[model samples]
Target: MEEEKRTVRAVERALDVLLCFASRHEWGLTEIAGRVGLHKSTVHRLLATLEDKGFVTRDAATDKYRLGLSVLELSAHLFRSDDPSVVLLPEMEKLRDEISETISLYVRDRSERVRIQAVQSMQAIRRVATVGARLPLSVGASSKVLLAFANDGDRETVLADPSWPAQLDLQTFAKQLDEIVSTGYATSFEEREPGAAAVAAPIFNRSGKLVAALAVSGPSNRLTPDRMHEYAPAIIESAHRMGALLG
Candidate 1:
C-alpha cells in the first residue's frame, strides 16, 4: 500500500512537471525542479522519461525543455471523441458552412475558457485558433458571454483580480455585461487577437445554466459590422441547438 502511494505521488509529480511548462514557452531542468518542488535528480529522471515518451523535448540549441508534439497529437485524438464534440460538431459545422468562417466551441475552466473544438472554414483567408488554446475570462466575445452568465460569486472573483489580462474598466464591463445577457450574445472586433473579429452566443443546459459558448471568428475584413450582424442569427441558432443537445 505504501509503495502504491509512492508510485502515485511520483506520477503526480511528473504531471506537475508537465503542468509547470504551461505558463512558459520553455524551461530548463533547474527551473522545472524548483517550480515543481521536486529534487533536481527526480525532475531530471522524470523529464527523461517524458522525453522518451515524446511528451517533452529538449531544445537543440537552448537546452531548454518544451512541450512535445505527442501531447498535441494526444489532445487532437481526445477532441475527436464522440462525447461533447460529437454532440456539438453538427452545430459547429452548420455555423461554419453558413458563415464560411471558423467556428469554435469553448467551455469555462475555473476562471478561464478553453477551446474544446474548432471547425476551420474552407475560405482561403480565415482566422485560425487551435483546439486547446486558453482565453481569459474578460477579453473575447465568448469569454464575456461566459462571464456574464456565470454565477455572481464566480463573476466577482474573475472581475476582482487586478492582474486579469483583459483589464477592462470594471464599471463599463459590468454595464456591457447586462447588454450581453439581455441579447443572449456578445460581439467583439479585433479585441483578443489582431485582424480577427468574433460573435459569440451562450449555450445553456436544461437547468438553464451556461454550459458553453459557440463563436464564429474570421478575418476582420470578412467579419465586418455588416457581416457580423448577418451572422448573429446563425450563431445564436447554433448555440440553441447545442444547448438542446447537451440537455
Candidate 2:
C-alpha cells in the first residue's frame, strides 16, 4: 500500500513537470524544477522519461525544453474524432466556393481560440491560415463571436484578466460584444491580421451550448465591409445548420 502511494505521488509530480511547460515559451531543468517544486534530480529523471516518450524535447543549442511533435500527434489523434475539421469541412468547402474566400472553424480553449479547420478559395488572391493556429480571444471576429456567445462565467473570467490583450479598449469591446449577442454574429476589420476582414457566427448544440464558430475571411480590398454584410446571413445560416448537425 505504501509503495502504491509513492508511485501515485511520483506520477503526480511528473504531471506537474509536464504541465509546467504548457504556457512557457521554453524552460530549462532548473526552471522546471522550481516551478514544479521538485528537486533537480527528480525533475531531471521525470524530464528524461518524458523526453524518451517523445512528450518533450530539449534544444541542442539553447538547452531549453519545449513540447515535442509527439504531443501534437497525440492531440491530433484525439481531435480526429471530435475535430471541427471532421464536423465542418464540407460546409466550409461550400462556403468557400460560394463566397470565393477563406472559411475557417474555431473553438475556444479557456481564454484562447484555436483554428481547427480551414478551406481556402481557389482564387489566386487568397489569405491562408494553417490548421492548429492559436489566437487570443480578444483579437479576431471568430474569436470574439465565440467569446460573446460563451457562458457568462467564461466571459467574465476572460474580461477580468489583467493580462488579457488590450488592443481594443474595454468599452468598445463591451459594446461590440453586446451587439454581437443581440445579432448572433460578429465582424472585424484589420483586427486579427492586418489587411483582412472577417465575419463569424456561433454554432450551438441541441442543448444550446456554443460549441464552435464558423467564419469567412479574406483580403479587405476584395472582401469589403459591404461584401461582409452581404455574406453575413449565409454564414449565420450555415452555422445554424452545423449546430443542428452537431445535435
Candidate 3:
C-alpha cells in the first residue's frame, strides 16, 4: 500500500502566501513569491485560489493583491464574541454606584474618542453621556487620559491636526501630558459640553498598555473642584481594579 502523506506542501505554501500580507497591505506577485519563498507560479496559483474564495483581491492597474472582506468578516465575528465592552459593564456599574454619577468608557478612535459603554447615575440631577457618541480627543477628560497614554505616533497625529486644542501649544500640551502621566488621571470642566464636568483615569490591559478611559461625569455645579479632587483617587483605584479584570 502507498504511504499516506502527513502534510500537504501545496496547502502550507498557500497559507504562507496569505500570511505575507500580515506586514504589508498589498503585494505584487513577485514580491509575495519572494516573501513566502515560493515560486512565482506557485504564488500566482495561490493568489488565484484565495481571490476565488474572497480572501484576497487583485488590483487591476497595480497588479497587486490585497486582503479581502472575508478576513474582516472573520475578525468581526471573533471580536463580537468576546467584546471588551462586556467586561466593562459590571465595572462601570460599580463606578456609577460608588459615585452616583454618570460613568462612561471611551476608546481612542483615530483623532477622536468614542464612547463604547456607559452607566448613568441613579440621581435625577445627573449628566448622561450616550454610548456610540464620538467626540474630539482635544477637549475632554476621558479623551485626554487616552491621549496622555497614547503612543508617541498617535499623540503626534492628534496634535498635528488643525483642530487640536487651541488653548494649549505643543510645550503646554507636553507639560500637561507629563502631569497626567504622573497623576494617572485627568479632568475637564465644561471643556467639551457646557455645564458638564468629568474626571477620567486611564484603563490599562494586563500588559500595562492603555486601552480605554473610565470617567465619571456630572453637571458643572455638582462636580466642583473640591468634589473632583475628592473623587479622583477613587476613580484611579477603580481604573486599576478594572484593568486587572480585563483580558
Candidate 4:
C-alpha cells in the first residue's frame, strides 16, 4: 500500500508539472521547479521521463521545455471521441458570438462546479473563465442551475457542506431554484465575483439526465441582471441544442 501511494504521488507530481504548461507554452527547469514547488533535480527527472514518452520536448539551445506531439495526439483523440466538451464547443462558441460574452460549460464535481470548456468573449472588457477552474457550487448562476437539476442527494450534499455561506437563507435559495426549474434558466448578479454576472441553463442528455450547465458570463456592467435575463432564451436554446447533440 505504501509503495502504491508513492507511485500515485509521483504521477500526481508529474501531472502538476505538465499542468504548468497550460497557461504558458514553455518553461525552463528552474522555472518549472519553482512553479510546481519542487526541487530542480526532481523536476529534471520528471521532465526526462516526460520527454522520453514524447509528452514534452526540450529545446537544447534555450534549455526550455514545451509540450510535445503526444499531447496533440491525445487532444485529437479526445475531440474525435464523444466527449461533451468536443460536442458542445460549437454551440458554446455560437452563444458567445451571439451574446458577446464568455460562455462556459460546467459539470458538478462533488460539491464544486468544474468548468470543462469555455469560449471567451472578444470584447475589450469581459469575464474570462479558465477551462479547468473549480468553484463552489453555492452562488453562481451555473452552480444554481446545476444544483436545481441535480438529484436530491446531490443537492442535499452540496447544501450540507460547511463552505456554504452562513447568512444565506436556504429556504429562499430553494425557492429560487424552483423558479429556475420553471423558467428553464437562472440569472445571478455579483453572486460569485464582485464584478461578474451570469445567466445559466441546464443541459440534459437525450435520456433526460442532467449532464452539464451552460453559462454566459461577463462584467457586471455589461451583464446586469436585466441584460442576462434578456439573453436567457438564447442561452437556453443553445444548451438544448448541445444536449440533443450529446447523443
Residue 115: error of model 2 in Å?
Answer: 1.0
TM-score of 4: 0.80
In model 3, pairs of residues that clash are: none
- Top model by TM-score, which number? 4
> Judged by lDDT, which candidate is best?
4
* Model 2 spans > 4 angstroms off: 1-51, 56-73, 80-83
Q: Rate the local accuracy (lDDT) of all candidates.
A: 0.86, 0.85, 0.86, 0.90
Candidate 1 C-alpha lDDT tens digits along 1-247: 9999999998999899988876787999999989988899999999999999999999879989999998988877664443566788887887788789999988889778999889999999988868778888878889998998888898888888776755468899989998898987899999877898999999887678788888899899889978887878878877887878775
Q: What clash count does candidate 3 reach?
A: 0
Task: Tell how far residue 233 is off in model 4, in angstroms.
Answer: 2.5
What's each prediction's TM-score? Answer: 0.78, 0.74, 0.66, 0.80
As a TM-score, model 2 comes out at 0.74
lDDT for each residue of candidate 2 in 158-224, tens digit (9 for 90 to 100):
9888888666687788888989999888889998678998899999977898989998988999888
Per-residue alpha-carbon lDDT of model 3 for 32-122, expressed as tens digits?
8788787898788889999999999999999989999898888676545346677778878988888999999899989889888889999
lDDT of 4 by residue, 1-247 (tens): 9999999999999999999997789899999999999999999999999999999999999999999999988977665557889888888888888999999999999988999999999999988899878888888999999999998888888888888888999889989888889999988888776998989999999999999999999999888878988898888888889999976
Candidate 1, poorest ten consecutive residues by summed lDDT: 77-86
